[model samples]
Target: MPAFIPDILAAIAMVGVAYNLAGAALAGRWRDTPAKRPAATPSITMLKPLYGPEPELAVKLSGFLDQDYDGPIAMVCGVSRADDPALAAVPATARTVIDPARHGSNAKVSNLINMMREVDGEIVILSDSDMSVPRDYAARIAAALEEPGVGAVTLLYSGRGETNGWSRMAAAGISWGFLPSVMVGLATGLAKPCMGSTIAMRRETLDAIGGFERFRDLLADDNAIGMAVRELGLQVVVPAPIVTHSCTETSLAALAAHELRWNATVRMLDPAGYAGSIVTYPLVWGLIAWIAGACWWVPFVALLARLALAERIDVITGRRTAPLWWLPARDLLSFGLYVGAFFTRRVDWRGAQLHMARDGRMTAEPETRYP
Candidate 1:
């Protein structure tokens, strides 16, 4: 190796650490910003797509029904199975759509297509079943959409572990890994992410995007939807008061499979941005510096900077996500996933094996495999 190569690697790693530090500071300010609650909340129809039973499923779904928004709100819970366990949690007042119809390979988008026909609200909200929102979630989202020229509103989310060590680790990955990256991306104007965390848009925006049918075959449907909204020359606004995404994995395999699918989805959608995410994992870069025979101080400073950034994010989010002991392991795991994403397009999701095409569409594979 060239003598100056290790120094270059060390420099790159330090830049990544500094980036995360700046992101954490920005996150603190974003988190402290006052929630923008709507003055007159409009009628809302929340579309929740569910599959099988998950930890805290009922408790989390119940939170959606207890909202404090002044407008009339209707919840639609869609499931493919007639005997799906998710049905038990559906509030009696909320409509339930049980359809086994397959519209392309994306079950969630198909579920939404079926659920959409029954919606009757001025604003449509698409949130994942595993998320829990506060009583004012509807009002805040409605307010965000009412902003001029904003076609869609998406909420940022923090991970909430339901049970076991794996679950907590999954949650930590979101808080320490994903959330900060998203903040940095938004700050740098490098990302436009529309997430199932909470996708709020007017019915007209949905129609303009060609409705749920357009996303039925896509792997990164959330981002695809965001792109559609942007095509109409309108912005997708991400508001404060991050929602809670339940990280309920019980085993390492479950967590790995879920995150791998996520990594593949994002990488498929934006290859350049995904590849550039390497610099965000400073600990992994630090390990690379050590392997390249950089001086011991190189990795030592990198680790300390990584730890400092993690602590800052933890304080900003009011959660202990990256404890010093677990920070290195998490960064390595994240880096490994990023590498794995380039090697395969197959993902295991919702008890099915699916192959992702270069265009980000997914098709079912005959046999299931876990990464």
Candidate 2:
């Protein structure tokens, strides 16, 4: 390792930092200047499939139940087991169904299939158990999917972790890193993801692609669903942005497991894109600079780049919730996660030992090993 190696690495890191800055700017623009589209037909069925009770789950589910949309609106929330606590928490405005049986490896989609039979709206939107939305969520999603060829619509979410310290950090990771990165990808036509946060679609288009059951075994179900719509030569659109529920990680181990599962899931879906994401971690590259050369200036540059990113993220995503001292440590940990993600092939998801296949199927390992 030579001194010049660090300088080169630092230079490389600056490029990525600049790219992220551009992305942050784009997110701010998207948030501030949401495309104003006239309200369309508002018949929508909001599907939420849940398995457990989470902190603030009541308030989150209630947000959708009390939507301001004037047209027909129905909600079909499912619980994997009849005893799952999530069903009771849903507001009475939405129809609730209890499904104890698992159709395939994917319990969420299984619940979706059961609930879909009961949905009675022209427009359908499915989200996870943890998402929270504004009163106009249904109206906006309906409007976004009004175009002739639009198959599905998704939203980029800013995290809201209301729990503990680690949970807040995890939220920041979503708001600051994942959200902004996705914005950059969309801005550049490099990434097209249909997120579960808010996947709006016409009932006909879902049927055109063989319905949600097609995603039963897929790990990145949302992405696969979006791709299937794409195969129909239909466009998957993303609305301005949405605020989804985020729980506190509560511990470093919890944060690690959470992010690692996500990374492995992405890797199984798109290996090339996952591998290329390394350049996005300027903090990691900066560390390589310091480790390779013992260069004092390399460390300073790393700190500067990281601080710039942190402050920029706060400003762009409207996330100033994190305390002053946590940014530095968070940046370092994020960089480490970026590097380590490349080597992980197995992840623990919902107490399941999931080994990611080259394709997107999450094959379960024996529960005994993980337990």
Candidate that scores best on lDDT: 1
TM-score per candidate: 0.95, 0.92
lDDT of 1: 0.83
Candidates' C-alpha lDDT: 0.83, 0.76
lDDT of 2 by residue, 189-244 (tens): 99999888888888898899998779887778888999999999999998765566
TM-score of 1: 0.95
C-alpha lDDT of residue 148 in model 2: 79
**1-371 per-residue lDDT for model 1 (tens digits):** 89998888888888887877787677865564656678777899989998877777878887887887789999899987787877887878889999988898888898999888889999999999889887878878888888899999997887867888788788888887888888888888887889989898999889999999998998888888999999999999888778888888899899989999998888888888888887887777777888998878767877887777677767766777534688788778878878988887788987889988998888975433222
Ten-residue stretch with the least lDDT total in model 2 = 362-371
Q: State the lDDT at 100 in candidate 2.
A: 62
